[model samples]
Target chain A: MKPHPLAGALLIAGTVPIKDFPLLLGKAEREGDFLLVDGQRIPCTQGTAAMVTAAVAALDYLNLDPPMALLAGDVGEGRGSRAIYDFLSRELREFSPKVLSLHYLLPIITPMKKVISAVQGCNPRPVLIADAGSMYAAKAAGLATEFDVFTPDAGEMAFLADSEATHPAYIKRYLFEADSKEVPRLIGQAYGCGNAAQTLLVKGVVDYIARNGEILETVREPDVPQMEAIGGTGDTITGLVSAFLQAGLEPHEAAIIAAKANRMAGKYANPTPATRITEIIARFPEAFKDHLCEWSGVCTVESRLRPATGGARQGGEA
Target chain B: MGLFKDKSSSRGRGLTLFKEVKEALKAEKILKVSGYEVKLAAPPPSLRKGCDLAIEVDLMGQAGVERVLRQNGVEFDRIVSIDTEELEPLRVVKVTDFGDSMMVRAGNMKVAFEKATGIILNVSGGGCPDVPYLHLELLNKKITEAPRPCELGFTLCALMLDRALDEGVRIYEEARG
Candidate 1:
């Protein structure tokens, strides 16, 4: 697929512990195990840092501009989450992004509603993707349908399938028992209950991409069993798919390619149970170089050599 | 006395309701151990049902608290901000008794054990990759002696398995006593 003119901000929003309330915005860079953004170092071992680092790496590999990150230091406290919500409510119009990926924020309904309202007010509405805490909040607030994509693991799928489940832990016993084999059923149940996004990238042993309760595609290749044990592999897939969506790939296509690339990246990393998510992410550039052409029907790998324009903080040092 | 004083002074307080008082107690222990500032509190009159107990938590860290609770397999009905509208907690576990054995289920995980010996007969359910590994670790062990599922595995399945195991042990102890 030929890349479109990179338009608007490719934005990632989440929380990490570095301070209390101030929202930090800048191009994200991975330095060692930490994600450095605007002089603030966020650990990449888990949560939003891992997701944003993988996304920044993928965009960088594609020679696209790195993502602009909106981060706060929220160590499970509400202050940083409130800060992020306040910023989005007050500044999202001015900081309109083309694609906004939400991760690891406290799942409070009022703030999430405010943030959604701010996002909806953007001149050109952003493609909204949610995972982890954001996804849970969206579902809890009955706003999952507002998102373009939700990247959920099997456990999360169970939560979505049970219309009454406000959180994964509280899903009905029968639904939880359904497991991965019940993903297709759960997808249908989620859509039936109006608790599903426009597109569901259900990540599991076999990644399933579904739209409107209909299965679009499945990618189970390049099997990397060790990837399951590694924390943040799901987050990395969410990051890659977010970048692909921002880069103008269709939602289903982005989901498919990202699933394959994540597995391939794992293969390239030759990961073990002890492997960190960053190691798999470090292989994204090589994995993309080897497969982007074939996957997207992009004419040549040479095209990737040319730097893309219009990315957030283009040409700025991290 | 000062330190033990109900630290429920945070402006943004939330309550986690469970189906049983035992569930609430278990969740409180898990949350405290996980570094959350939480306390067991009586559910408001409007919220009381099967369980009179509820866990009070700082609303600000609700997401983190919920994640930890879920990770450790502490099943709760719903976490509601104290200021929000009352929502009822759902009872998700079911205990079924057979002549020789009993099964306790929480979410997708089930623990069945011989009644006389409390030896685990089967551990099943959950779709996470860790389920099979956890199943192996818990099978054939006495409910009280089996390792906690959350300690041995890292998945929602493991958490649910832990929930089942916890319930199973409680039932066995109650029967014996």
Candidate 2:
């Protein structure tokens, strides 16, 4: 079955790097932090470049034609941080995005609430993807349940397990140090406290998808051990989940496909500690082909996911 | 005067029904299974048109809940509007200054900050998972430089902290003057 480019827009909220994305090999632009979307410049404040990079990579995989505007923002420090809330409110109200990804906001409490309010006000509530620092914010703000899915690493899994602690830093050492098999224990603990979201994509050596405290599926194939050293891989997973969800896949299917696609992309990149994240992301388009086939169960390619004239990489900067 | 005011009695709008304990419980289960937000409440004695056990449902879910009840053959009394106006109003926050530090209290949440440096000293209150983290992030940071609690918080506890933080900043500015 051919994958469909999502009709609904994918809006990513997170941090950006100190340089403009689509770097020239080893060189970063001398210009300060900013994001270039289709050659238009937007100020990058609080989000990370890794997040935007991953979202772009996922879009490449999905083959979204004439790529839609990616509304990404940086939550600035101090008084400027309020701008994050204002930005989210304005965009969420106007765009009515199908998927709203909350990623990498500062630990400050004020802006977190504002973002939640803006999201709550959105009509036809978006399928929310919360990851990294945003996961902490969502869980901390007690908005974890409001999100459709949470992508947490092993360490983050421990944080989620500790219902007593607000921050991962405060989570009990035992919980954080527990083995992978014990993940179900932590999921139980978090669920007991009503802290867990509707769906959890716990990413590690093994990626497990759990709904309502029950582990539904686990994706463990094509695991690249070295992918751990490469930062932004988790961010890439969040992006893929958002993109897949926008494409109308259920949370369970999206999580599974994203996990498989990410590992597949890493295998394609064949990275060591030396491999940059960008190279791994570049591989998503091709990696998605095989995975989408697995997802659809039909042998033939659908026109929706067919590569464009110039090919997939031409879609956006990953 | 009666303890409750008679508002609109339109079953098409927000309404809940009270049957016997077992029936009410069954209706609650059926409505919830059908995905209606159902809450158990004691219907005001003055309006005791049914059993003591009443299920309060959101106005939007009224039709769906009624349909489910009808489909399940769950018997219920006429639905009634809740006198929302009689509910207690929001609590007012209080601010206290200790010269060296200041504290603001709103409901279950409190935020304290040092006066001289304008940095936040501590944030406390709420059982939500986010409170301890919010406290960790805000602790020992200069209030003026600190992130607004409202932006980072998602629960009533977080909102209360934001309120306290707002007052703490206000008091800090006053102290400076």
Candidate 3:
């Protein structure tokens, strides 16, 4: 396998079948609801495809190298998942990405363990982010703390809070009933049980960024209520955070910014309950442009020319 | 039912409502087998009319209890939290017919099969890791002969797929009859 020396991030996700085996690696582009990569077209309507496509859009907006994607054709069957695990174990040694995001895959413990081991052994260990099935598998296998960040929705958060529950379906009924309002308690339970990563980006009506069991930040502004019901919006937030991490932002910071940017994207999309996730993803560039300067602490030309006032630092120094 | 009439006694407890007493009893059994502290009780008269029962569980274990019931295919109508407001059970399954083929979707998980042969045409959706395994297990096989998704997988997606499979099998059988 050729090395991806310049690859800042790697997205490992699965797509609905198109007859590809092992893995397909390349820069990705969204054409309609399909993610075109390495001479293959993967549907982006949901799951890993939606997440990777949203990440690619954010990376493109930031002018970073498009994420190196490792995709397998999986429609729930373990073939693509097994292929991904095998590829990661055998080929991850050749690539050294700064950010590694794991998305949809079947939660198979043994092979997943090998892949995690391989990832841990990488030189200059990459920042690990897991969402969807990857997060579920990591938490289920008791390896969630090894990752840098976990992006979970309220439903998934309930799973994390119930240390004994291996999957969301089995989370304690009380925790699930608590819903979004009980996220802080769930975060505490997750961290208390050591089932959470170093940081958690909990997506919901109000996005919470927690690190080390402390709620560091919560972003509720630019609230697009309709975004909650839209499939793949949570996936887009994971994608945005992964790109921000690739851009050298701290996990917590990346999570906060991603949450805000996602909402802004939703606002830009002017989404209704009927809006498609792709429509929201399409506004990522504009969303990033609107907030990147402030979020990254970069001075715009106009801000750079502003005079210092009221003991503020000169030259637009935040 | 009179035992639950004292509202204060129900504090910090949630009720899993069911359309029938049998479903409540089944849910209680499933939750107990899964190690949850739950009881089948008559709901307060104000909560429901008729002879239906409710499975009361510690509010703290609601998510886990519900999950176990769902995984076991023991359906309930809804879960009422301590607030007395109805928390509608997620009814995510939908079926679409394409003449020879029929597709059933439960949440993000989808399963489609040939109506006449009961052969699964495709298995798709879901972000769970076991999906690939379940997909491989169900695809290109007769739906009736394949292992049920919940038996082979552990995630909610698998349970949802199992629901789809159940619906698919029912549709296929009814068509043949």
Per-residue C-alpha lDDT of model 3 across residues A1-318, encoded as one tens digit per residue? 544544345554554444444478787776877788886776665567778888788666655556668887654435676778778888776675677888887655556677788887887688899888778778867889999999988777877887666555444556656746889999999999999999999987789999999999998898776665455788788888887777667899889989998999999999653456778888987877777777767634234212111212234221
TM-score of each: 0.68, 0.55, 0.65
The residue ranges of model 3 lying beyond 4 angstroms of the native Cα positions read: A1-8, A15-22, A299-318, B1-126, B129-155, B161-177
Sort by TM-score, best first: 1, 3, 2
lDDT string for model 1 (A27-126, tens) is: 7888987888888776676457778988888777665677889888653334566677778889887666888998866656667888999998986788
**Local error of candidate 1 at residue A9 (angstroms):** 1.2
lDDT tens digits by residue: candidate 2, A1-318: 322233246666554322122211010111233445656454322123445555555554455432243332222221222344457755565556667776654334445666778778876677788875567666765667777899887657876876644444345556645777888788887777777888999887899999888889998988786565344577678777876676567788788888988899999998653345567767877886656777644423233333332334343322
Preferred candidate (DockQ higher): 1 or 2: 1
**Each model's C-alpha lDDT?**
0.72, 0.59, 0.70
lDDT, ranked from best to worst: 1, 3, 2
Candidate 3 vs. true structure, TM-score? 0.65
> Which should have the higher lDDT, number 1 or number 3?
1
Sorted into a CAPRI-style docking class, model 2 comes out as incorrect
Candidate 2, overall lDDT?
A: 0.59
Candidate 1 clash pair list: A1-A296, A1-A298, A78-B60, A177-B108
Which has the greatest DockQ? 3
Q: Which DockQ-derived CAPRI band holds candidate 1?
A: incorrect
